[model samples]
Target: MIEIYTDGASSGNPGPGGYGVVLKAGKHYKELSGGFRKTTNNRMELLAVIKGLEALKTPSHVTIWSDSKYVVDAVEKKWVFGWVKKEFKGKKNKDLWIEFLKLYKIHQIKFVWIKGHNNHPENERCDQLAVAASKDKANIGIDHFYESEQAKETLF
Candidate 1:
């Protein structure tokens, strides 16, 4: 089974943000992280899962651990499907959730929620990666959706 641990951090609620992922399968391990100039913690949280699943080259049994209840509860309780049925109206991370579902259907996946900042080795490592990425000026990337949405909000 592939075991994945993920974490997300934002310097401010809608400021610089990043996601970190630790993926392990058998003897193989990989780490992933990226930062966005303008985004939210929830977007980073969901994007971490999306990125982890996208990195898998083949379908496999996978288990994901995350600290974000927003992510964990939505999937664990199957609220995402209902949201999709409604065309994701009034949802915040529709883009990431849509991306997540696309990759999600190709593999057998399970999610477990863990407490953050509690010294779980992988989780702590992910948090470090996320925080550092968020602070890395040269590597920061644009969150197009977030920026565009903010622009729209400002115009209206």
Candidate 2:
């Protein structure tokens, strides 16, 4: 079984954002994260999980650990699929959630909730990655969800 730990951070709710993912399978371990010029923490949180699952080279059962109730609860509570069904009305992180469901169909996934800033090593590493990724020189791209909304406002 593979184990994954994830975390997310945003300089402001709608400011620079990033995610962290720590994956361990047997003796293999890896960390992943990246920042956006503007984004919400929720997007980065869910994106971390999607990225980690995509990183897997083979099909395997994965146990994901995350401190975000938004991410963990959405899956555990089965609200993710429902959001997709409703076109993600009033829901955040729709793009990443869609990507997550795709990979989820291919792998056995389980979610575990961990308290943030605890003594867990994997969780701690995830936090560090999130912070570093947010400060990355390459912004990659600004989150479109917010940018689109902003565009709409300016058009008025």
lDDT of 2 at 125: 93
Q: Write out the backbone clash pairs for model 1.
A: none
The C-alpha local distance difference test score for the whole of candidate 1 amounts to: 0.94
Model 1 residue 80 distance off true place after TM-score fit, in angstroms: 0.6
Model 1 segments beyond 4 Å from truth?
none
Best by lDDT: 1
Each prediction's number of clashing residue pairs: 0, 0
Per-candidate TM vs. native?
0.98, 0.91
lDDT of 1 by residue, 45-117 (tens): 9999998999999998999999999999999999999999999999887888989999889999999999999
lDDT score of residue 29 within candidate 2: 85
